[model samples]
Target: MERTLKLTVAYDGTEFHGFQRQANALTIQQVLEERLAKIFGHPVKVAGAGRTDAGVHAYGQVVSLRTTGSIPTDRIALAARSVLPDAIVVTAAEEVDAAFHARFSAKSKIYYYRLDTGPVPDPFLRNYAWHLADEPDAAAMHAAAQRAVGEHDFSAFRAAGGAPVNPVRTILAASCRRDGPLAEFSFWGTGFLYHMVRNLVGTLVDVGLGRINEEDFAAILASRDRNKAGITAPPQGLYLKQVLY
Candidate 1:
């Protein structure tokens, strides 16, 4: 009988193209499937909670596997470690209900964007955070981020090409803080459309730099126009922090 196995995944998106499978490029999903298929002795379908964008990383991504074998789920981490690449790791595994759907059952997600405002970007963190010599005002970014709270039409921050069914989303928390030379922005929301978090970060960066006022940020959400927001920030700086079921 096929039982549902839940696996928590973490990966460095610097090398792979993205979470979703691509035509020729490597992806987190493809890699995980290949390895899990080998272990299961059959190709297994791995469903992820969120398919993060290109260059985007994840620390608490959740994926599910349907397998017939009766391998102990607690030891799945060790079994997967042998085949998984250096970039991706399976942190935890367990048997969840068969009805649990990784993507559809998700209640909320948390995303983090890291920025390095140091004078010299550390080689260690260069691939992890966005490097910028000029520092942004933390207070300003924090203040502007608060404007996105509650339910609002996030069309201004979505990707231009996506045909979203709904633009309304509820943001539970949004804030930016500085730790030494690192500026980290975090957002917890019910759901996000394509490029929404990155675009929101870009606009918040502009606010931190005093380029956009609080009124303008509010206006962008009210306008529900993509052109009103700033550029889509690079993906390397963003991470799927967690997915709440």
Candidate 2:
């Protein structure tokens, strides 16, 4: 009998192209599927809750797969971990309802972006955080972030080259805070566009740097033009923090 398994996964993503499988490219999904297929002695199709961009880490990524193997669901994570690279780990696994899907069933997602606002970059954080030469105004960034909350067209923050689709999304929370040399941006949303959070952070950083005021930020958002927004922040600073069911 085929059983559906849900997995809570975490990965460094430093060496991955992204979460999706690509032709002749290394990816988290590719690695996971390869290892899982080896374990089951058959091809396996793994689906993820989100396709995190290259260099973006994840702490609570969810994945689902159907398999005919007789391995105990509770021990599947352990068996998978024995073969997966150190960078990727299956933290938990369980049999889920047949109708449950990792991506389509998700109700919301949370992402966090980290910035090191220190003059001297920390070597320890080189692979995990974006480094800025100087600290930006946290208060200003936080205030600007509020503009992103609530439902709106997010074309200004969406990256190019994506398939045409509705640009509107609902943000439940958006905030920025600073702790010593670390600056963090947190976003909770029903859904996000391509590179939306990164672009939003980039624009908010501009506000923090005094390049744009709150009113200007609001206007840019209302304009729905990508050119009005700032550059896309580096993917290293981004993390898929959670996926709510």
Candidate 3:
């Protein structure tokens, strides 16, 4: 019997190339599908909601796949645990309607980026947060982030290659805040282009550092030119926090 299953996953991503299956390098999807195929006694193709980049992490990444295996929904996680690595965890599993898809069926996604602005880097956060010796002004970043809280052409924020067919995306909300030496940024959006969040964070950090003001940020958005944006923040600090259905 064919059954569709939805799985909520979390991963460190420190060692993963990305979420998609690659021909050579290791990936989240490849590991997941391989492990699942072992339990199901058949090849299983798992589809992830997002193709997070190398070194990026996830707290609530969602996936779906069709299988003929008889494994009970409650036991899927346990079964997967036996075969999967320590960095990947399947937190929840359940049977869903066949029409469900992990990507196309999603409504929106939330992403978070963290920066360690202390004079000294925290060894514990080496793989989890971006450490900057020079502190950034969180208040200035917050103000600049507000300018992105609406639908706009995000061409200026996208990476050089792999441009999406449409450069437009809706940012439902955006905020930046700091506590002590840690600065966190949150973005809720209908969709995001490749490296959009990281690029925004980089440019916003420039604003925080006084390299660019709010006016320049606004002008960059209006120009829709990638050259006007700042550097792409490293992937270690990025996280796919949640996907809203």
In terms of lDDT, the best-performing candidate is 3
Candidate 1 segments whose C-alpha is farther than 4 A from its true place: none
What is candidate 1's local distance difference test score? 0.90
Q: How many angstroms is residue 113 displaced in model 3 relative to the true structure, after the best TM-score fit? A: 0.6
RMSD of 2: 1.1
Model 3 C-alpha lDDT per residue in residues 62-174, reported as the tens digit of each score: 99999998888899999889999999999999899999999999999999999999899999889999998689999999999999989999999999987457999999999
TM-score of every prediction relative to native:
0.97, 0.97, 0.97
**Using alpha carbons, what is the TM-score of model 3?**
0.97
lDDT of 2 at 178: 88
Better of 2 and 3 by lDDT: 3
lDDT of 2 by residue, 1-245 (tens): 99998899999999999999999999999999999887776899999999998899999999999999888887788888888999999988989899989999999999999998888999988988889876789899999899889999999999977779899999999989988888999999999999999999889889988999998999999999999999999999999999999
Q: Please give the range of 10 consecutive residues that has the lowest summed lDDT in model 1.
A: 69-78
Worst 10 residues of 3 by lDDT: 156-165
Please estimate how well model 2 matches the true structure, expressed as its whole-model Cα lDDT: 0.92
Look at candidate 2 and tell me the lDDT of residue 187.
99
